[model samples]
Target chain A: MNNMEKIQELRHFLARYDLPQDRPPLTLGHPQADAVLGGGLRPGVLHEVFAGNWSAGGFAVALAILAAGTKPLFWVRPDYEAMEYGAVSPNGLLELGGDPRRLIVVRTRNAADALSASADILGCPHAGAVLLEIGGMPKCLNLVAGRRLAFAANESGVTVVMLREGAQAEPSAALTRWQVSSAPSRADDDDWGNPVFDAALVRHRAGGLGHFLMQWNPEHAVFTTHPGAVVAAPAHRPAYPQERRAV
Target chain B: MPRLPTDRLIRRNGAPSKAPLVVSGKSGNALHVHALEARAARLGLYKGQPLANARAMVQPLAIVPADEKADAALLEAIADWCDRFTPLVSLDAPDGLFLDITGAAHLFGGEAAMLAHVTGLIAKQGFAVRGAIAGTSLAAHALARFAPAIVPAGGEAAAIAPLPITALECDDKTLRALRHAGLKTVGMVAERLHSELSERLGKSFVTRLRVMLGAEEQPLTPRRALPDLMAERHFAEPVVTQDAIAAALLGLAQALSEILEREGRGARLLEAVFFRADGKVERIAIKTGEPLRDPKIIMRLLNQKLDALADPLDPGFGFDLVRLEALLAEETRPATISFDHDENARRQIGFLVDRLSVRFGYTRVQRFVPQDTHIPEAASAAVPAQDRDFGPETWTLKRCPDDPPRRPLRLLQKPENIEAGFPLAPDGPPKFFRWRQCQHDVARAEGPERVAMEWWRNPGLTRDYFRVETKAGQRFWIYRDGLHVQDQLAPRWYLQGVFA
Candidate 1:
């Protein structure tokens, strides 16, 4: 075909189908438990997660958001050291086919500016998600500021994730509040290596709650499902000897 | 009255047609002319006599030359001084001023009170002045010259009735013609038919008369209008030293900050003027990296700016007045302070960058932003350091992986063309290449990463880039032009950058 004909063909091919619009909904590690809770966390609402011994769950949630096709994720974590999180590298999300330019890490002066910037980002329609590290926020930004930020997020169609430092009993404007903790999946012996405890979802929006067992593969920088697993009721006996004694 | 000669000799041998000055051959042979009829009567001189005979009749008469420029300059100074009452003062002519004191009247109690105040002030300066108020400037001008000091609204014609034809400011020839025509007052001229008036003396004369009677409205040009954002501080006593000026600036900055905070905005550029007591003024200005309303921070920035001023603030006498104005403003959200040490360090870095930018010039400091185009030169743009918003760039090297790959430490400002042959080209690495009369040899070589220019822009050339290691283990990025064609010129080579 001639060059002009080839150009016309390319244009016709491009106009054949519209681009895909489906995006994966947020995957709250314990799917069954989250399903029991009201249809997973509300799509575009603020969710507050209080930090515990293992801060890795928060980092996992951040990656999940990016993997869900959320473009331009604003990470406003002042106290959480990005380097320690193991995904602070510029191309950390490249394995997921994510655009490196879409990830923005803002090193704010303090929790105040971080919260303010998070609110501003949430109010902007172009933003896909905003993660506010209000672990060290001043007392001034308590309930009132949180409600304002939530309103802004709702109006702009942006998801907000607040990373709290310590255990807080109540959340002002969070649609779903969860507390994450670490525990072993099972006591079964695996040939590969010793079974380490996978982070568990101890609390959720609805009354339902559970835990997931997973093994970390540092070499590939990812986590895989444990070989053998056991599911138990909320008050069931601990599977590990050490966990049972502690309980 | 005494009988006076109508014709007399002006020069030694000629008799002029116009009236001449009387002169006396004896007692100094002085020439004298009667300017005022009262003075001539007092001096025993007749009106129609020749100057030679009049001087013979009256001795020791004084002659004074007229000073027109000095009179105009004095009038201009009076207009400038009138600024104290209102900034909208304008000079009407050589001897008149049109002050638009509509809103300014209340500042001095009322309109009549303002008129009395201005007249008293000018009278104190030893000048004879008259002022009239009317809706239109033309009407005001005519009334101030011929009519009463205060003309009732819409009564311009009646107020100017008894005045002579001179009040119209007609030329000498026009005045003589009017007098010859027996039209002695402005009221008489106003009564004449408009068509007849225009045919006899042209349209301008009639137009001027119409304008003076409020038939048309005239616009007044003011001297100074209010600025967008201004803050002024008047000290109890004049200050001279730079320290005093700096202290006063703090107060002004606080005032400006309060206003900006109330309006939910911040200033980007600010200018400060010092009106010295000795009639001299000094001005200094500064621009901030971001819009800010913090007085302490703004004062600190201004202090650095003041230190960088080329001209020293001597304050020769003292400065009694200081004014601060905001030239540009923008809405900004206040930042919160963090307790984390690393985060604090980052904030400190932003401040240091702003200071260094102010000292080195904004354009000199730059940040790199990646562009989407494939062309090497079009892949990045250098933006002002202060204006850069920190974020990841979208574009990447075509062959490079999405990792922290090694890159050249320094990129040449511009590419240099070279001719490579023998050992340097044709499928072989160079043993030695001459660059700036210095020879360098290749120790290792990496492949040709092909990069093509954007063809849509214009006719483009393709490049084949290679990473070559020298004997010293220093790697250099070099590229070659389009490959050889049967009828085209040979390819050229250039060294683009060096990796540390």
Candidate 2:
């Protein structure tokens, strides 16, 4: 309202760009997925992955590894996730080329607790990435909670990947939305191969959407896009086919 | 504290009646007086007296039932309240406390002022109080019973000499024997030779006498561990508002940090004690991953814990005293410079872990540490992040180079049973299986990998494991109960975990 206060506000606005949180996008290494993502998945924002089983859970982990790099990755899950879907194994993570030593797991009692814990985890700039796995559609995960999480993530510049299982897509403040599931591996009968994903970029705030059948190379821990397998879909609406089970 | 049972009752309700009150309990088959108020003791009534005889001697007697449990709890509560005076307060059983104020007397001016302050406050709460200060606990215990006076150094003998021999508080048999030996006063008992006293009263009694005479010293066993460092604030008027409580805590934290800085040490476990004006106490504790000395960080963790408390801290009538104590401490480690911001980031992560642990629980926030073993389930264990004693962990990949992950990403604590049958071969992997009410047709399969149990472990069943991929693309690692033997019972199948 006054000239001096206006000048101070302009100075505060000018100071924010100097922060190191404004960095380049992290490439997912998949040509099709990266191009649709406008180069790649951007850091310092909220990303949501919707799926029914551990197949999508694994993909969420792969994205977390990309965002986290060599830093600590905190995975917060409600206790119901373990009871129904099984516990998250350290050996499984080690096999997937993620550092188990740099991982911290917080198993909260319910979705409310998981959300609060993730908020705290995201506030800490030291943590490179935080994965929050919520089970059912609890009332606590409303738009306000989503907006609060997004604000915290933006303030600290830590990437947050939320794995929502067994719930319908709801409106939120996430930057990108994904629908992922497991796809058959490209190996013969006697050889069980690497993890393959049917990842659909349903919602992108800054770019268009695309669906790619990607296979993960666990030895290198990156996605390898298969050429000529783009599924025909529209981006104006939420992606993924109707009549899908549960999620 | 002498009539604690009666005092507790009288404190709960005002004095019930004009008649003297005695707490009675069952001794043998008859009711006997267990404890009595001062008014009752002044009459012919005394402890251990049968009710029938007491009622026959005095008219209009009042009797109350004895509750040992309530009495002990009250004593413990009083001991907790006494923690404000000294951290080394120990219970002296049924009705007394021993305060080891070896170097703490100066805070209350001197021994005389502290004694007067403690007894005066306790008496203000409507409990009869008597206290004394001496060179040793035994001397103090004896003097407080007969005469409430402070005994100076090297005056232990003269101070207790003129008192009756009962002041020594020896056994009744020993007192009767001492009286029979023409020793009515402690001075008369002290006149005998050491050998004569030991021969008559026994060696333990003589040692007790020596301890009482201040010729020997004994250490007091405190009821709780003594804090490494402590700082407290005493309010002239009790504080009830949130702003006042916060200000008090900030002050105490600053004081504690100053002390810590002078000693070049930091605290690992910090506790806050709130002594309420209504004689109730509340304690809150927080633990850290590393030795922390910063006041701001300490207050932040405390605030986080306070917010996450199941029932928020209530200022019942307001707190009269607030004390901050470091229950555990360690020497501060100098920060090491790294090529990147790794060191600073690690410290920040540690603080975050501490905050989350306080909000959730210590066991809920954990890091995976690789164990040195061959067993699948025992390969890694989640240790609480607050404790750094687990040491370094280097994960060794179970799979060979360029091969698919042999281990499942998420291992269940225990395996669940599933129905499977119709393998390509008798010992081959199952063709199809039913799990969680869904039937999955196996398109690709690998295994019959036999894993025998170690000899040192419990004789668990040796399992033949398999990794099967369902036609829908979900991969599962399942195992058969035992080996394929001739004429053995049919082996059951179990689903262990799923591949990510």
Point to the candidate with the largest lDDT. 2
**Candidate 2 structure quality by residue, lDDT tens digits, A1-247:** 9999999998998556322245578988888778877678788888999985668888898999889888899999999888877788888888888888888999999999999999999999889899898877999999899878878888888999999989888877787888888777744444567778888887776677777788777888788875323463554444654512211
What TM-score, computed on C-alpha atoms, does each candidate reach?
Answer: 0.44, 0.91
On residues B1-500, what C-alpha lDDT tens digit does candidate 2 reach at each position?
77888998888876867878878889789999888899888987888889888888777888889999999998899889888888899887788888987788889999989998899988888778788888888888888888878998767777777889988888899999999998998878887898999998899888887788788887889998788998899998999998899899999999999998888889999999999987788999988888877999889888888888898889988999999998898899664556677667877788899899988999999888888876677788888988753246778998887777888877766888888866777887788888889898888878877878776875678889888888767788999888877576457888988887
lDDT of 2 at B408: 87
Quality of candidate 2's docking, in CAPRI categories?
Answer: medium
Q: What is the DockQ of each candidate?
A: 0.02, 0.61
Model 2 chain A — which ten-residue stretch has the worst lDDT? A238-247
**Lowest summed-lDDT stretch of 10 residues in model 1 chain B?**
B1-10
Docking class of 1: incorrect
Per-residue error for A56 in candidate 2, Å, reads 1.6
Q: Write the per-residue lDDT of candidate 1 for residues B90-120, one digit (tens) a residue.
A: 8775567888877778867887888888887
Tens-place lDDT per residue, model 1, A108-163, is 44566567657756655556677666553467567777777767766766778876
